[model samples]
Target: MKFLTHTSIAFILLLFASTSYSARIKDIASIQGVRSNQLVGYGLVVGLPGTGEKSSKFTEQAFSTMLRNFGVNIPIGEKLKIKNVAPVAVTAELKAFAKRGQKIDITVSAIGEAKSLRGGELLQTFLKGVDGKIYAIAQGSVVVGGLGAEGADGSKVMINTPTVGRIANGAMVEKEVISPFSQGDTITFNLYESDFTTAKRMADTINNLVGANTATMLDATSVQVLAPRNISQRVSYLSTLENLEFEPARGAAKVIVNSRTGTIVIGQDVKLLPTAITHGGISVTISENKTVDQPNAFAGGKTQVTNNSTITITNEDSRMFTFDTGVSLNDLVRAVNEVGLAPGDLMAILEALKQAGALQGELIII
Candidate 1:
């Protein structure tokens, strides 16, 4: 028998158990025109301890601009050795319906060659949206989650990410993103995952709770519901509609295989066709022995060194398992477990079964 070696088996089986739970409309879908906007800005980080960028042209230009704004101008082409400042990019999400003076968290990332952003403070920066409008202003002390230390001999030790930092409530919203929630007499709910069955069920549930012809299924992902024209009444109607619960359609059967980590995720709806599987393993071992052969003390003969190597191969007897038609997921799992096959072996077995049309589900390998 051919020998197969250098095989390491590690199994992480994720079996999703089937459960019946009614989910609320709000948990499964989101109202149209209710979303956050991304805002980004270029800024500077100051007060670093010799870890900032030393020779970045953009950093120097930004520093010069800021100084000129304060009525302090340096001679043209004069190099300033400001090692405590680093150019950075600031970003934040402006939440929907955010009012003026509202505070939001901001993320600061080094855009220059800064070694670390620890002990740095972000200067005032205006964050702009996709439309080139300033939506928020950010300025605060950065809180880095990582730490680093360096010695004189270029030895360095670091933990986590020392270049990125965050600030809680670092940005103040100066403008609000307009939403169309209050303008339309009918509101549309878009499901996170588009499914025709799910959309129909949601529409039916809403119509039954509110009234007949109150909800309409627009497509596989959106459902429109009629609401009162009055703003106060519309709010109350939405509150009632979001809290109503209904069972969602079962997801499609799928098996996710991670080739790198030896992980297999089996869906609850997976079924097996009638088939027989045989699993076996072959192991190879090599042994080496070294010995020195010396002549008798008075013979004066040269000594010799000898090396002996032994190779052994063993193959386990293959075991067969049979599955009847319409085998459920639980039964398939129990049968596979009884075989006591390693993860690598099981992975190969699943691939073979998929190819042979015995597995009644999609097999996705990552």
Candidate 2:
């Protein structure tokens, strides 16, 4: 009786529970008329810790070329020995509706063979558009990702990846990105995650708020809306439409397994069919301890090598547990894990189950 009650309560919660929270239309989709433009620039990173590019002629030649364009004449073949300069590539996105003077964040990556970018300063870098026009400039102290430490014997330790860094609000826009919403009578809203149910619900929500026939779902990917004929009114109309709230559709059922980290994440929609699974593995660890043999005074024994070795082989080949006729996803995972199956074992088992048509959901391995 207690088991039946608990199962009934859990099943009810699963049906009534919200899979997703409410989000504004702008959060789930984008205004077809307005979008952010991608902007990338090639520039230089300077003030690196003595590990900048070496005395390669191309590095010096590139630096001299840029300097000459800045109206500095240091002769064509002068040996410029700048040890702190490192070439870099800077890139950023000029967001949609970004004004002429607004600031956007930029990411600076080391393109050269610089060992580290800690405490480096970016030079005056121009971010150009695809049309070869300068739109913004980036120059700031980089924020490296990790810390580097070295032991007394020159052994080093580092975490994450310090090779790349970011600059918050680093680039200031000089030219405004062209996003004009004054021409079109209809605008299409593109959902980042396409779902027919969510798309229909969104269209219905918009039409209910602004009366019938205001918004129509063109297909599962886009929803078309009729804006006011006037430019100012159209802008205001679209702004209101982008703020309406509705719940998004549930994503596709999938089981994502990370082999490197032994992590498994199963979506709510994931399911399992009635199937028996048997998986086993073995872990053998070999360890060695070295010992030096001492020679007795009168004996003819020199220094000899004595190794104390140990080998442990753990084989988990227990009897397979029957899943019965009714096995839920959570139950299947728990049953597999009861035999001390590791993450990779679970991944392999899932792959086999998928191949055998026992796993009803998608299995994605990372």
Candidate 3:
């Protein structure tokens, strides 16, 4: 009996060890009608590092006009000399059912010729939603990720896009977006990704957790759930339903390659078919050297322009390999990596393989 118990424990451990991780419905699906709304507004950023937007007539006009609203009316169309201001568009996300007095992060993007938004303070600006309704007020210092400098002679510098910036907890939610929580007898759930298998699994999970007939899969992207008639018990139902565990269907394996970065990511379950592959890299360089030859001691005429240029072209090719299809992803990755080709080269090879139907996995270039 002890031996049988030990065998069962070993089998259970083995099963656990072989289980693969899958995205859960709780992690991928949101409760029906629960989402954040996008809010955007045009505002200004003050105190920049002289990289602010070029003095546009409209920029100065707006600045002067705004100042006039504060009882200091500067004449419109006057030449306003401003050096420390940058016109920016402020944007923020208004979470679903966000209540008043809640703080949210805001992003400030430069609209003018501002070199960098660094060390800039954004004044209190009202954020409006697409419906043209003011929902929140934002005020904070902008944080840019770029810098610049000048030198007497031509100087080299780095470009990190100093125009865009972000402000953490910069906006305050003043108005709540009206989302009816109790509008009907049923509530719908939306999956983050459209997966038929996941949708069905989620519906089954919910039904099993609540009752036999409470949830039904509507389609690959949505699930309709019949809420409990007792509103008081609905919250409890949802709480337990999200925690239910079940294995998700294994998705198709894929390979994502970034040609520019020479990056290759192999998804689980990637399979390769038998194929012959060969790749080569060729580099060409052309350089020109200028020389000046002057006639000395009345030797000849004036100096003539002399130019020397050289062009070099070189190429290295890899031997063709007949690969076996149906190889596991790890083996395939190891074999390909052993070829010593760069990521960019691998990307081209993957594209060719995919076109030839030699690779069974989906190849996504990003």
The prediction achieving the highest TM-score against the true structure is 1
lDDT of 2 at 308: 99
Q: How many steric clashes between backbone atoms does each model show?
A: 0, 0, 7
Model 1: per-residue Cα lDDT over 277-336, one tens digit each? 988868899999999999999998999999999999999888999999988776777766
Candidate ranking under lDDT, highest first, comes to 1, 2, 3
RMSD list, candidates in order: 5.4, 8.0, 10.2
How much is 103 displaced in model 3, in angstroms?
1.5
If both were scored by lDDT, which would come out higher, candidate 2 or candidate 3? 2
Q: Estimate each model's TM-score.
A: 0.88, 0.73, 0.73
lDDT, residue 92, model 3: 94
Pairs with steric clashes in candidate 1 = none
- Model 3: CA > 4 A from native: 1-19, 47-54, 152-161, 229-232, 272-325, 334-356
Regions more than 4 Å wrong, model 1: 1-16, 282-311
Work out candidate 3's RMSD over C-alphas.
10.2
Give model 1's TM-score versus the native structure.
Answer: 0.88
